[model samples]
Target: MASRPRPPPPAEEQVGQSLSLGEFQNVQSLSLSAARMILHAMINHRQKGSKDGSIAMPETETLNKTLDYLELFARFKDQETTQSVENILGNYDELDTFEKSQLASLCCVEVDEAKTLIPSLANKISDADLKDLLDQIIAKRQFMDS
Candidate 1:
């Protein structure tokens, strides 16, 4: 009998311990705030460019739901705060893009909570450093609120 060819690796989208994002592995990941900003900008641009002063592109139910969810859950609202959070996360060379986005979006108050929520973060950063990062994020959020 002829020898069989080796099978390809599975393309599961795993984010725990280590990332197995499959097709998205090399793609840039955005935080909830960033995603919200981009979507809002696109919507606004489309609306502004319409000849009839109406939405150039029809809004789908999925788009409306996504916008609503982002409005409710996105931690940083304004562009300045969003940029600050991005900058803070970007400074951490230890974290991958996905990890940084997860950290920014979740905005966990404690190191343990962050690690518990983002298991991959457990071995990536020290508890004290993670706590400091969390503090910075919280402080930015507080400043935005006030």
Candidate 2:
């Protein structure tokens, strides 16, 4: 008898009320600010570990490009502000981890805008609650900038 062929993988990843992250299903999602902090800390640790106290360039061109992109887009520059944003998002237990991260990274100002960007958020949170959350995030951002 012939052996059966294996099934093909999912055609695309989806993130709505249900997440279909494919290979990344178990992976923890991170906000851009958090990713930036982690990458910077890792570079600092490498620098500290080296004899010259200076880190080498990122191992790959992709990593170098990623670092540059994060530098340009990461919203929260300081740890305190990042933590505040995380805390605000964390309070909304209904949100998925991906949703929380997207909220922090995108920094959407309006409920409709957030819902349009992260469709899963539409059914999970009411407009008033989302507006309140956005306001809090905006306030933190303003404080950081000032």
Candidate 3:
């Protein structure tokens, strides 16, 4: 009888192509592909058009502003992430509001010791700001749930 060697397990990374800065939580692995995919699904999923659809690129100003915002957001976050929020948000701006908001939530959690972060977050965001965001989010959720 011959003995066989056991196969090693996959590295503690590259689990899903659907993770983002705000969504990384207790991440056992931080696959770059998974992170990119998550951001794409969250932000750029909407930019896809019909079979003959056109791809409209944003103006330089909008792109830059968006980039700045995402970057600033990531800086404020306090978690370790596979990719920068700027990278994800900049690449995924084509997604719809719901998806964008979801992605934002995922990448910028206020919980302790998450795998990802967004500095100066709203939970740590002002009470008034938090209230507004919560109300709006709740309203949006109600609309979506309905």
**Top candidate when judged by lDDT against the true structure:** 1
lDDT tens per residue, model 1, 16-62: 98777898898899999999999999888888879777648888999
Cα RMSD, each candidate: 4.2, 3.2, 15.4
Pairs in steric clash, model 2: none
- Is 1 or 2 the stronger prediction by lDDT? 1
Model 3 spans > 4 angstroms off: 1-103, 106-119, 122-124
Better of 1 and 3 by TM-score: 1
Candidate 1's C-alpha runs over 4 A off are 1-10, 51-55
TM-score: the better of candidates 2 and 3: 2
TM-score between candidate 1 and the true structure: 0.87
lDDT assessment of candidate 3: 0.39
Error of 1 at 146 (Å): 1.6
Mind giving the per-residue lDDT tens digits that candidate 2 earns over 22-138? 777767789999999998888777766675765565457887899999999999988889988999998998887888899999999989899888888878889999999999999
> Model 3, range 50-126, lDDT digits (tens) per residue?
22376644436765575455544432222222234323433533332333344444532333212123222323334
lDDT of 3 at 43: 45
